[model samples]
Target: MNELISQAIAQWQLMHSIELVATLLALAYVILALQQSLWCWPAALLSTVLFTHVMWQSALLSDALLQLYYAGMALYGWWRWQQLKQGSAGSRGPVYEWPWQRHCWLIMATAVAGLALGAVMANYTHAEFAYLDAQTTVFSVMATWLVARKLVSNWLYWVVIDAVSIYVYAQKHLYFLTGLFMLYTVIAIAGYFIWRSHYQQQPAVRLSV
Candidate 1:
């Protein structure tokens, strides 16, 4: 019993230690991204690198994998944003909104995929809140892509995802992340308005991607 207790305490300390630094970097990523700063990608890359290990240790496989994806997207986002800034893409500005039809299809597809993944994990593995985790992971994947693509509506997607993430992290006793997601939810709302304003100032350019 003493041995188990000691192990648990050590794990808790380690998790919190990592979470603290990851949270700070993640905060930096969000703030910089809000400002359309290219530096956000490097911050996101480092933060997700730490989160991948943390989520894997917590048995959140979907989230762990998502962190890996985020790391890759961070690099891609930086390159793409740099191109946008340089006017290499022939675009007026960095932000654009997807049509309602596209958003509808995206939501339907994401829901189906999330359900399928959740069912597989629930039956074949020991994952906590399998459906919720899978759904959030799927939506986050889409949101992150939209962010990289500089979609104005990405912030709206993140607003919903971050709010849901608060409950998910809380269930795992990751109090720091729970608080971070709470902050994220608020920031995402502000981001939507800020990006929308920027988008409105530009000549509308729609490109199918």
Candidate 2:
């Protein structure tokens, strides 16, 4: 395992040219979004475009497609969050959540979709470690939905997604990326608690309102 890790790090360092920077940029985007900064969307858009190219270079077509999803989501999230904020009628921020009912639906739907995606990847794709990749991909689609909604619980999804990506990237010898995911694991924990506290203060802002 140590030898493999070392080998992974060696190769990753050699390929650190553009992708590494894009990864860090993406991380910064998430950090800002966690802090409830709307600017994070545009900041993330740059990384997504950069990653599209980087993933193409790595021949990760699905992963590259993930960046395209990010682009679309970023636009949607930017618009949605802005409208919510503007609609706040004064000082209220738009950090509200989906009701628990909708939340459960998101989870159930995400699970079913993730399973279907995993099967397709496991059976029909050239994606490295296909089951895991597809699982992460589908989780991401769900997670992206949550983020767009500005649901505080999205941080919990981030933790799960990051945990899964750690193993996925590690196997692909993307050690730097794996390390970044480990950092995301830590950040997700912080983000969850932080967002939770924020939501607790604003419990009055349920989806109905």
Candidate 3:
């Protein structure tokens, strides 16, 4: 057990600084998004760009495409957040609750979208692990959309995605990043419950204003 743990530690310690920086930015985005902060989209976009280059350089073509998708989502999310802003109240910006139903629909839609992307990737690009790649990308797109919409269940998708990402990263010897995703799993679970509880107390309202 000690040997195994030591090996894991050494492997992680050998990870490059660039990858470490990308993970930090990713985590920062998640934490900010969880707090319902509008800055999450832009911050997350920075991480996406960094990771895109990293993945492309590492020849993880599918992952590079995923980051490009994330870039697009970030733009949409930024716009969505602008709509959510209720203007500054004194010093702080106003915020509002989101309906849980939106999250449900988003998840369902993502599954369908993933199937379509998988078909295209399998037919055209030299995308390795085509189906799995498309699925993760699509799920992430949906999850990001939910976050942008201020939906409470966005973290639920993260919980699932992060779990899978950990194994995938480990298989590729990205031990440090695998550990980062593992840590994110705990945060995602906590965020899910916290946001759910908050959602429960919201009064009936059509719009978030």
Candidate 4:
């Protein structure tokens, strides 16, 4: 019994260390993202890589998959941001706003995709909050893409996503991650206003894009 308890304590310590490291990296990613710094992608890449393992260990399969996707997006976002910085061909310069109609269509498509993913996970896996997990994963994918594109509205999407994520992480007893998401919610709210200010300052030529 003592040996079993010792093993459990060691396991808990390991998990706690991993979660703490990932949480700090994720926090850095968000702060850099809000600043529109290229370094954010590298931070995100590292955080998601750690989180993929952490979420899998926690039995949050969809969340694990989302972290994998985030890892990929981190690479893409880095390249995309670099292109923008260099004023390369096909790069949309700086912060820009997308049409409301586009966002409406995007929301509908992702919502349907989330429901479908949730149904599959519910029927096939012993996943917790399958529907909710799928919804957050799908929307987060979209929001991450919007961030890569430098869309001003992505922060608004994150505000909602991060708020929901607090509940999700809390349910899993990931207190540190829940607190991180809480911070994410506040940062996202600030990011929206800050990005909007940047958008308003962009050159008229870029605004027409």
Candidate 5:
């Protein structure tokens, strides 16, 4: 156990400065987002930019591309949240729940897309863990959109994505990133219960409006 701890520490110590910065920013974003704070968008944007560069350097092309998508989504999420705040008298928007049927469709779509991306990357690129990378990337995009829309189920999706991401990063010897995702999994679980409770307490009038 001591030897394993030492190895993990050494790997973490070797992480790039930008990766550390990104991780910190990402943690901040998740915490704020869980609390339904609008400030999370800016933090997410900065973190995604740094993470994009870090993933590219690490040869995780799918993850790098996902980060680029996240950068763009950050802007959209910011604007959308601002609109929600203004429309609702400066309060965070109501949390929403999608129908089970819609989620089933989304899951099917993500799986198909992941398989296609995995096949392309396996055939044409040196990307490692292509299927797993694609799975996380595709689902993460969906989850981010759900978060932007204030969906209560977004945390559920993130729980699965973050858990898988921990393994992916660990396989690449990115101990810092692996640890970050592990924390993300816990945060995602907490976010789910927190949002659910808030949703339950929300005025029916507000939801109808």
Candidate 6:
């Protein structure tokens, strides 16, 4: 076990400086986001920008593109959160649960999108783990949007996405990334329960309003 740890550390040391920075920032983003801190969006933006370069260099085209998407989403999420914090009349209410029917439809949509993108990448590019990449990308896009919308169920989607990402990163010998996603999985679980408690209070908040 020590040897494995040492080797993983050695591998990480050999990785690009930007990758290391991105990993740290990504961790910060997840932690702060879980705490509902406004600072999380900036952390996510920087992390995704660095990761875009990292994934592009690693020849993971889909992931690289996904990082760009994440960067954009970070900005949108920041603005959305700000609006919510300001109590704008047009802004959506507190964290809430999506209906099961909506989640079912989302899952089906994500699968179909992943399959389509995977086929395109497999046929037109040399991208590694095309299907897995697409799966993670599709779900992550939806999950991030859910987070921005303050949906309580977003963390549940992230648990699955992060778990799959661990394998995807491991296959590329990105041990640090694998470790990061593993942490994300655990944090995502914690996020679900945390948000659930907050969600339960929404009814009371509304009643008192």
The residue-level lDDT of candidate 1 at 60 comes to: 92
Worst 10 residues of 6 by lDDT: 200-209
Query: For residues 1-209, could you state the per-residue lDDT of candidate 4 as single tens digits?
Result: 99999999999999989999999999999999888888999999999989998899998889999999999999999998888878843333578887798889989999999999999889999888899999999999999988998889999999988998899989999999999999999999999999898778766434313
- In candidate 3, the residue pairs with backbone N, CA or C atoms under 3 Å apart (3 or more residues apart, or in different chains) clash, namely none
Off by over 4 Å in 4: 88-93, 205-209
RMSD of each: 2.1, 5.1, 6.2, 2.4, 5.2, 5.8
Candidate 3 residue-wise lDDT, 1-209, digit = tens = 99999997875554456688888888888788767677888888898887887677655576788899888888988887776565433221333455568557766888888888888878887766677767887887667666766666678888999898887778777665788899899999988887776666554435442
Point out the worst 10-residue segment of candidate 1 by lDDT. 87-96
Q: Give the alpha-carbon lDDT of every model.
A: 0.90, 0.77, 0.74, 0.90, 0.88, 0.86
User: Which scores higher on TM-score, 3 or 5?
Assistant: 5
Candidate 6 residue-wise lDDT, 91-113, digit = tens: 33466576688789989999999
Instruction: Using TM-score, rank the candidates from best to worst.
Output: 4, 1, 5, 6, 2, 3
TM-score per candidate, chains pooled? 0.93, 0.83, 0.77, 0.95, 0.89, 0.88
Candidate 6 displacement at residue 9 in angstroms: 15
How does candidate 3 score on lDDT? 0.74
Q: What would the per-residue lDDT of candidate 2 be over residues 133-196, giving only the tens digit for each residue?
A: 6667777877887788877778888898899888877876766678888989998899888877
Per-residue error at 198 for model 4, in Å? 0.4
Indicate which candidate wins on TM-score: 4
Q: Rank the candidates by lDDT, best first.
A: 1, 4, 5, 6, 2, 3
Q: Is candidate 1 or candidate 5 better by lDDT?
A: 1
Q: Whole-model lDDT, candidate 4?
A: 0.90
The Cα error of candidate 5 at residue 200, in Å, is 1.3
